[model samples]
Each structure stands twice: as C-alpha cells, then as structure tokens.
Target: MKFWQRLFTAFLQRFHLMRFFGRNRSFKELHQSSYAQEISKNLSKRLLNASRTQTNDLLKQFDTHLTGLTEEQAHTQQMTVGLNEVTHEKPLTWWQHLWYCYRNPFNILLSLLALIAFFTDDLTGSTIISVMVILSTLLRYWQEAKSNQAADALKAMVSNTATVLRHQVSAEDLELMHERYGIDTKNQTTHQFEIPIQYLVPGDVILLSAGDMIPADCRILSAKDLFVSQAAMTGESMPVEKFPLQKNLEETSALELDNIVFMGTNIVSGSAQAVVLSTGIQTYFGALAHQCYGY
Candidate 1:
C-alpha cells in the first residue's frame, strides 16, 4: 500500500509540473529564427516591427516565457496580446458594412416589380410600389448606419493590454518595477515572505479590462486610491472606493472588505494590480470570449 501511494503521489506531481511551469517545455517549438524572419510574413509586419528591436526583443522574451505555459495558459496569452489593433476594412464613402443589409433585397424585389408593371403598362401601381420600395430602402440604410455607429462606440472603449509587473516577487522589487519598469503594482501582498501576487496560479491571472468587462472575481492587492463601481455585480448606484487588501475576517462581507475587489467592477480611479481569484463565466462580467483568435 505504501509503495502504491508513493508512486501515485509522484505521478500526480509530474502532471502538475507539466500543467503549470511546463518545466519540460520544448523551446524548440516556441522560438522563431528571429524577428526579421517573422517580419516578412505580411502586412502587420510594419505595425509589428514599428517598435525598436529592443521592444521586439522584449515581446520575444514574453513569447519564449509563454512557452512555459500549459495549453490553457498559451491560449489566454494569445488572446490578450495586441488586442487593440484594428484590422477591419473601411467601407466606401457613402456605403457601410451594414448598408447592404438594408439596400440589396428591397431594391432587387422592387426593381423586378417595377419591370413587370412596365411590361403590363400599369403605371400607377408600379409607381406606388416603387415609392414604397424607396422608402423602405432608405429606412434600412439609416438603421444600419445607426447600428454601426453604436458598435464603433463600444469598440472604442475596449482595452487591448494591461500594464502589469510580469515579475514581482517581493515588495521591494514590486516598488522598483513600478518606479523603473513602468509596471503598475497597486495591488500586492507578501505570501510566505515573498510577494504573493508573483505566485499567481498558472492560467488564472487574466481578467478582461479596457472596453471588455472584467473577467472574474478579484481583490485589490495593490490599490492606489482606486475606486470601482460594481453596480453590475452588486447593484450599487455609485462607484465604491477601493480599499487596501486585507485578510478576510468573519465580520467582513465581500463588499465591505476594503482590501478586496470583485471582478467586473470598472477601474474608476488611480491604478491597481488585482489578484484574480475566479474568472470566465464565474465572474461578474458573466461572459467570456468563447472562440480564440490568433495571428
């Protein structure tokens, strides 16, 4: 029994290692020859390479490190990177993408009726149908135009990337990374004497921000007077003042706890690094991107 238990434990440990750190990851599959080689791939090459070689190197390092991710981690990384770059094509001066939705069918049907009336010499009925078709066509055009505008507004609010300290192991380095590396460190803690946020469980730190709704439930680990209105999640009317992270006490509810912040709450003020606890449909946003897109 003891031998079986030991062997089972070892097997579980090996799977855990591969599932998280991916210590056995084969870098050979992750590394590309060089950025220059990748640049020749196509159009985004310009936007991709517009940054300095040093910037490209940083991105390269990120990708290489991403190689240590489990299958799920790799998918999330691909989703968040450069999400703001717009690639949709613009329509002609007067026509929009949705314009065809309104114009095509009505015009075609009315044109056929008009042609049939012309052959039969029934000018009055043909004229009335023609007018009706024109009115409907115009209405459809206007409807599509308004829909496009609203969608654009929503897209404008979306955030593509969050600036966070990718490596923060101690409060000392946490402070330094913010000061020097341009990394934000508003929410943080020391766990087992090292910064706890750095030890975030694999495949769980990401939460949607920017225009996207928050992706999960979380607490503020580093709050610099940050405020969040969790009305969507909690039905509060005004934005709540975010407090410093604190240990949970029996008397403290999730909302009253100053140190903790829930997912789906907007970042109302200042800046922060939230410690994500739950995500996806489990979060207040209640929705997550179901499909993955990568370039």
Candidate 2:
C-alpha cells in the first residue's frame, strides 16, 4: 500500500497533475510561506512576459475569457489574492514628525549652538536659539502634516473607479440558465459596470479609453490603435502605441512589451480590452510602491 501511494504521488508529479488531484498549494499557504516574495516576483515576471504567449493560453492560466469574470469568481479571487490596492506607509505621528523636523542639519546646528550658549552663561542667546528651534520645528511639522493630508485626498479622488465587464446572473434565473446552457450561469452574459478600483481583482476584463487610468497590470486581449502614456513608470514623455500579441516577441525588458499595460499608466488615445494579470502588491506599480516605502 505504501509503495502504491508513493508510485501514485510520483506519477502525479511527473504528469503535473497534482492540481487536479487537489494536492496544489492554496493561495493562503503560498502567501504565508517564506518564499512568498520570491514567488510573487516570479509571477509578476511571468505575467510581464505574457506578450510572448498566446491569448488563449493566457486566458486559460487566469481562468477567464474576453467576456470577463463572473461576480462570484471575482469575489473569490479578491478574497484569495487580496484587494487591488497598494499598501501605503503608516503616517508619521505628531511626535515623530516633530523629531524629523528637528533632526535636520540646520536644526541640529541651532540646538548645539543653544546648548553652548547656556554653558557659556549667555542666557539671552540661548533663550533666543531655543525659541527659534521650537518655532521652526512646529511650523515645519504643521506644513508637512497638512501637505500629507491634501496628497491623500487627491490620491483618493484619482483612483476611485474602473470600468470592467462583469457577468452577473439573477438568482431566479440561475437554475434555468444553468440547465439551458449547461454552463456556469455567470458566463452566459457580461455587462459593463463602473466599480471601485479597490474592489478589482485578477482575471477581470477591463475596458480602456482615453483619459482612463489602467486599474491593474493586464495583458492586452484586443486593441485598436491603443496609445498609453508610460510617464508614470518609464518617465517617457511620448505616448507609446500598444496592441494585441499576434506573434511571440522577445524583449529584454518588460516595459518594452507592447502587449502588456501596467497600472498607474493612463490611456492617451484609442481604446483596448485587456484581462487583469496582477493586482495590489503583486503589480509592477505596487512593487515600485513597495520599494519606495522601504518594505
């Protein structure tokens, strides 16, 4: 019995059929592993090179179609992979902000001078320097806190919503649609809806038009003269044209792949339909954000 079990496991591994046998690691398990970061980076790289893959193959990997993902599937994916939002650094507390303000070279020099003045019995000079340091630190802290609040508000307004094709079925028609089509009722029809970008997940099919920000890293399914401004990522002033992958193309950098669009970029002209490849901290933009936050 032991020998047979070992043989069966070996056969499944050799055939890459462990997933079918329910032996594959769950998202939660992988996420909690020590190699999570390495796995995430590899997944991002794979999606970035998706331009070299066929559209059907890419769709199969994501378990989605051009018609988009069903509401239930999207919800499940969200729960598994987490939200399509970047993690931000914790805001500095008042004391921390004050410390930062006082830690500047100018403030340090002033503090040292004030201390020296006190030791030299120069009461008036020390008092003036101490007042100057306090006033400067308080003023700087207030200005920085206000600026941070304004920046947060602007960011909230900017990333509000995204247009995606979601398949939703009424509860009453669920059985009828399932019986008639002999398919998951959610796949029967797709409807365009503007949903909050934070609710977005991998496998979503999104529509892009001029002025709309790309919600997540996605592979282009079909495009029509699609032009995108990659200034946010590449600092390129000129908008680059993008299109569907008609053939396998080798590229040195993921940015050079015209078939994949990244989050944080916006459409400059024309339109496109793309399936989400990565989201949240797993996306290109999110990775950059993670680095910037020193995570």
Candidate 3:
C-alpha cells in the first residue's frame, strides 16, 4: 500500500481514540462501556444470583429451543459478548513508548539544562546529561517493550485451555471432544473438536469429566458424583461435590451454590453437563484475578 493511504487507514481506525485536550483513550474502553450497558438491566443481575433451574429458564426465555443455542445463535452471542479473555491493557506502539520516556519530568528538565549549557559553550554538564537522557530513553523503551512482549508471550502460551460442546449432530458427537482430530468411522462422519475455552459462548453445553478444567462460569445441568477441586481458586484444598439444584435457590449467592462451577476450578471426579453463563473477564474468577492484580 502507498504510505499516505496506509496512514489514512490507520488514522481512521484509531479515530475513536481521539479525545479533548490532546488525550487518547484505548478503543477497548469503548467496547467495555458497551458491555457495561449490556449488563445494566435486571437480566444480568438475576443470572449471577439465580439458581440452576432459574438460570435454565432464563436461557429458554431467550430462545424456544431446549437443545441449546443453534449455530446462528452461538455466532450472534459470540459477536455480542466477545472472546473469553481477561481484559489486557492495550499495547503502545514503539514510538509512543519512547515518547512516554522522553516526556519524563526529570529527563525533560535535564534536557533543557543540557541545551542551556550547550549554548553557553560549557561542554561538561550538558554533554553528560544529554548523553544520559538519550541513552536512558532508548534503554527505557527497550526494557519496557521487552518486558511487555515477554509477559504477553508467556501469558498466551500458558493460559488455561478448555473443551466445550457446541451445537452438534448427536449425543455421540458431543461425547467425542476431538471430533476432527479423531479417526473417522464407517458411518462416513466427519469430525471436529470442542472449541478452545476462549471460544465458548453463553448457552453452549459443556461436557465435564474428571481431570477436565471448567472453561467458563457455568451452572450444572446434570451431574454424576461431580466432585471438583476448587482449591486453586476457592483455596479449599478438599474437593467439593457439585450437583443440580432441585429447587431454585436465590438468597445465598451463585458462588455458594452447589450447582455452579467456575473457571479456574477443576473437576476431581465424576462428570457433568453444564451451560456457560459467563466467560472471559466477565467471569467471577477473572474478576478476582483483576482485583488481585490491583486493577
């Protein structure tokens, strides 16, 4: 692409960040604000506190089907809700990071002093300060960018992975998590895999088994001796047995409910079927991480 055209395209894409007083805010802030508006109503408030039956009813209320959301519905929700990821600070370009270092208060003062000394024909103070500021600016950018890149790479490499059930052909298909990766049968059936945890959306049925990680905050639909080790998140070393709530329990709280499993918790024994209610930073565990990190 031509330089000017590419520049114009970049400018327009970043136009939403334009603000008064020469300030800039990330485009992520706009998305977050939009998401906040989505959860302001009673619907979201009830989901966090409602019991299993009530939560299922809410899902049915949104759609007529009992087989979970159709592919179209899942896609729509994916676009509406976005990826299941913790919110990250938007990365700054190299120039922005360098400019940030250059604008440091002490460095700015030293730079001005250096300029004054230079014009006065005294080489010692100005020469030393100027060299220091330039080298420091370069070093600061290098350190900051390198650290940011390494953190991001490590985070991406090690983030928890999950398996989820999307709208599928049959019960048998749902049982085979790695549908595509597995060998084909004489039935001539093509296969696929349960999507990554990050791809999970509301209303998807998650098949849980022993040693499987709970991808998103979910409500138990049916369980068979489902004992989960929530120690990593809940700090309770003992495994907690989770089951479906017979009656709609409300006053206690979702976290206290035996029917709900959350992200970052693992299933220690038995298996269950669940529906994802929240994912990404909207999850309870994600919020806990954000708070622990002093967000």
Judging by TM-score against the true structure, name the best candidate: 2
Q: Write the per-residue lDDT of candidate 2 for residues 1-295, one digit (tens) a residue.
A: 9999999989866544454565434333444455545644675468656767788888888888778887678778988998888986556667766776777789999999999999999999999999999999999988998899999899866646787786654665455434532335454444676677887888899999999999899889888989999887776789999989834365545776878898999999999999998899888777666544334
lDDT of 3: 0.66
Worst 10 residues of 3 by lDDT: 16-25
What is the TM-score of candidate 3?
Answer: 0.62
Query: What order do candidates take by TM-score, descending?
Result: 2, 3, 1
Q: Per-residue lDDT tens digits of candidate 3, residues 101-161? A: 6876889999999999999998998899999999999998889888988998998776454
lDDT of 1 by residue, 1-295 (tens): 9999778768755433223322321222212224223322431232222221232243344342211223234335535542222123234345433344444665788879988997899998799888887788777778877887898899777533332233325566556545633445667552111122222232333332333333345544445666677675456688777554343334223345554454446776666544343333332222211111111
Per-candidate clashes, comma-separated: 13, 0, 4
- For lDDT, the strongest prediction is 2
- TM-score to true structure, per model: 0.38, 0.69, 0.62
Clashes of 2: 0
What are the runs in model 1 whose C-alpha is more than 4 Å off? 1-123, 142-160, 168-216, 244-248, 251-257, 287-295
Reference-based lDDT, residue 69, model 3: 59
Specify the poorest-scoring 10-residue window by lDDT in model 1.
286-295
The clash number for model 1 is 13
- Greater TM-score among 2 and 3 belongs to 2
Ten residues in a row with the worst lDDT in model 2?
23-32
